[model samples]
Target: MKDDNLGDSLEYTTGAEAMGDGLSRARTSFGKQPVLGILALVASMALSIGIIGLLDAELFATWVTFFVVICVPVHIVISMAWELNYPSFSRKLKQPLKGAFFMALMLLVAAAIAVTVHYAQPIHAGPPTPFVLMYVIFCVLVTFWFVIVWNCWPLSSLLDNRLLLGLGILAVAYGGGYGLFTLLFDFDAMSAAPFYSAAMDPGGAFPAFHVLAYSVTTVSVVFFCLLFDFWPITLFPILRAQPLMGLVSTIYILGLSAAVYWMGVEWLDMEPVKLMVNVSIGFLFGSLIPLIMFEGKLFGNLRQPWKGIAQCAVAVIAAVTLPSIYWELAPLVSGPLNSGAPGYQYEFWMASALLAMTFPIMVVVGKFLDFWPLRFAPIR
Candidate 1:
């Protein structure tokens, strides 16, 4: 969801000529770029709000689920693994336009998943909500274990082609996701279509919401690590290498998220789903502005922990403030959503809009296209 190993190549300049015509990484002929960055963020925000206005809140959440289920994996493939290796895949359309094509493709695949989940219910013999709510969302957390935590290990070695590698990784993601879901999540908590079904329940060790909350919070923990440039762990050289770093970091993060979850839920009496949406994913979504939209350059020069701390501060501020605004607007925009009270919970529409919809739009604009419409140019 953030830029990694990507930047426009720039030459170094020096000495007497440094101030002359020589170009530098920090030098630029691109004029008035911050304005364009602001505009891109604005466009994404407007699109997210417009979508909420257009759909019923429940319907909005359904599609949001669809996007989370498919879009993140697709992004890992095309953007992260493939690194958009084939612009010709879209007939070599110029950038920004080409990026739009890629985004559309991810959406199309998500829609396909939505259709299958909806229709397969006849065969599965239960409501589709369980699949969407449990397997799909957890698939996100599971896949991150592969791509991010595992660094796409064995598979990255075994699969050479980008398409094949992506498919393999996604397979592992969903396969592992299903395994974890079956192993841990107690569907009894939601089996009666928001009511408990103790008889039909899978009777797993952890409540579905508990596992779900922890999984998502774990991802946010990873983002915090990334914000620190994989710090503390990255501080150690031997453990800084691939699988070891991933393994150690994953263990550390899982425990960290667990502690955070435990304190928030047990000590503070916060709801799991609410905490996931408002704190975990919401913080990541808010960090997107500084991290993605501005290319993280705003803090690029800062040293570890301090930089991470500063960004976390910004994320906390956004997490606290934006959701309140979204909540106020949700009823008016999405039309009569419940206030997320038990038995009538529909409040996640706004949070989902911020995380699933707005976040991706920002990624498309800022990361994938290098903030297109605002080129990085040489100093004149």
Candidate 2:
């Protein structure tokens, strides 16, 4: 009787294994999470609205930005944790939520640095220190909340492996790009070489110019890298949800940069151009680059040599020409108008035309300099 029972149990276990495999194959082809999990996301947004409504007007806006910069990831983590720990939600929700939670954590560290600076400087007129502190605290709370969510929603075996690989690749690419740029180029290599050197010396340059230029440039670089990498981890949902998602995403990014710029400049009295450039740089580096990278190919084998060459060409041209564009345009709009207001008008149009012309220049440059070993001279 004991031997018969053992054989029966083994047969049941084998059957369950076969069933699991079949379900997973179906999920892979369909590529969506359980519908209920998406509803939970809507509920989370409603909760977020309640929280924001409690804050004062100025604080409310900051709260909204905090939610945007921080909370979405928290929502994902919460869902993941729920599904992981309880094993109740559809397994599809678990992986993306987990990835989002991790990303939120990374952004938290970056935000902490930003907040720290916000407090240290007497930059804003009305004492923005309190607002910055609240933002930081909220971010930390959200991170922990997501940790709980991650505990709840355990991912399927397939998703767990994929998430790990995706994160690893992103980390390697970011560090590698930053390291390469720092090592290869000196302050003299950039158009804003003087500004770069000034930033390092005993006393930094004026706050406005520094903030504007550095912020935008940093943003620009990040986004540009992201675009080139073509990470479908972010792209999959995007492609599915909206037909014009790319344009929408680009506009959203650019608008966010502009708003951040306006705040740094108009509110905090930073130089407009400097703030714009820095914000642009940050967007370019963080999101734009990654978007460009991931746009065309989904699950395609990575291209080599030419990919790196194209990135180099774009980066170099952008760094040199963008500043020149800014420098040439500034005087026309702001400088005292003499008899040649018309000439200034012409210069404005000419600069715009030149900036537009750089697209073809990029193509030409790519052809000539795309090869390795500094054919004549490197882009820097």
Best by lDDT: 1
Consecutive 10-residue window with the lowest summed lDDT within model 2: 2-11
lDDT of each: 0.64, 0.32
lDDT of 2 by residue, 198-304 (tens): 33222223332333243334344333433343233234565322223334444554565566656776798854443443344323322312112222222234453
Which ranges of candidate 1 are over 4 A from the true structure? 1-36, 87-92, 115-127, 191-202, 374-380
lDDT of 1: 0.64
Where model 2 places Cα greater than 4 Å from the true spot, the runs are 1-57, 63-204, 222-299, 305-380
For residues 101-157, write the lDDT of model 1, one tens digit per residue: 777877776677656655644344443354455667677667666776666776765
RMSD of each: 5.9, 20.4
lDDT of 2 at 355: 24
